[model samples]
Target: MKYLVMVQGTQADYEAMRGKASPGSPAWSEQEVQAMYAYMSAINDDLSETGEMIDGQGLAEPAHTRTVTLGDDGKAVITDGPYSETKELMAGYWLLECESLERVTEIADRITRCPQPEGAPNYPVVIRPVMEGAGDI
Candidate 1:
């Protein structure tokens, strides 16, 4: 089965990208940042060797995003980012072809342990099965 593993992050995490302190939180040290990059690289390498990873990538900050909706009159309405209303933003995602849901869950669990600042809470990873078309519809 194919599954999507989505990693979420808060606004604080996004601010860290620009070398800015997350409000009251301290900035991430150089060592800490390097450690996280190394950890993610190791995981991706392992997945590639195992032939489980189909595709995966981290996303840019939500400040670069735009929200579009349809108005009652059928015009497109657009709003700028910050996405402040949302508690969590999708930070990254991994698409994997795995044996079962259990395997995917295991992968996600490992991802939660990736390096981060001390005292940071474990963020949630949303896993969903990819539906394949059967050619009926």
Candidate 2:
């Protein structure tokens, strides 16, 4: 089976990483950033060697996002960020071909341990099986 794993974080967290002012947390240090990248690269390498990784990518900050919806007349309506109503934004995702949900959960668990600023809370990794056919959808 294939599973999609989504990583979520708060807007404050994103801003802090980018050297912007957030409410409380300080900006991430260079060593912390490097460690995070190293940890993610190691996990990707492991997943690739195990034939579990299909695809993965990190997303830009929510400040750059836009929300689109259908207007009353069927035209597209657009709204700008930074999605004030929401506390968390999707940070990244990974697609994995694995044997079972348990296996995927294990992979997500490892991701949850990826390096972050000290005292930073662990974020949830949302996992869902990928539907490959119309019937499944």
Candidate 3:
């Protein structure tokens, strides 16, 4: 079966880290950023080599989000999106072709232990299994 592990983070928590400093200031120091990038990159490479990486990427800040609504009349309405409104925003995701839910959970556990860069705030990465249908193949 194929599964998607959704990485989620709370808006308040995200803001706490995202709004840490001046516009030009780096959220994390150079060394911290490098550690973080290296850690995540290693995971990405491993997944790719194992054929478990369907797609994955970090998103830009929520400030650029936009919302759209539609009515029964089929007319469309657009509005600004408050990306932080939800309890958690999906930060990143990975698609895995695994043998069972247990296997997926094992992978999720490994992902959960992703090291935080030195001096960086700790964040939880939420994991969810993708829904499957009869047509799934």
Q: Highest TM-score among the candidates is held by which one?
A: 2
TM-score of each: 0.89, 0.90, 0.70
Badly placed stretches (over 4 Å) of model 1 are 23-26, 134-137
What TM-score, to 2 decimals, does candidate 3 have?
0.70
Clash count of each predicted structure: 0, 0, 0
lDDT of model 2 at position 82: 90
Ranking the candidates on TM-score from highest down gives 2, 1, 3
Q: Which lDDT tens digits does candidate 1 get at residues 1-137?
A: 89999998766776774456765444677787889889988889999999999999988877777789999999999988776586778889999999999999999998988987775556788999888877523
* lDDT over C-alpha atoms for residue 129 of model 3: 59
Prediction RMSDs, each to the true structure: 2.3, 1.6, 4.4
Report clash pairs, candidate 1.
none
How far in Å is the alpha carbon of 120 misplaced in model 1?
Answer: 2.0
- The whole-model lDDT of each prediction reads 0.83, 0.86, 0.64
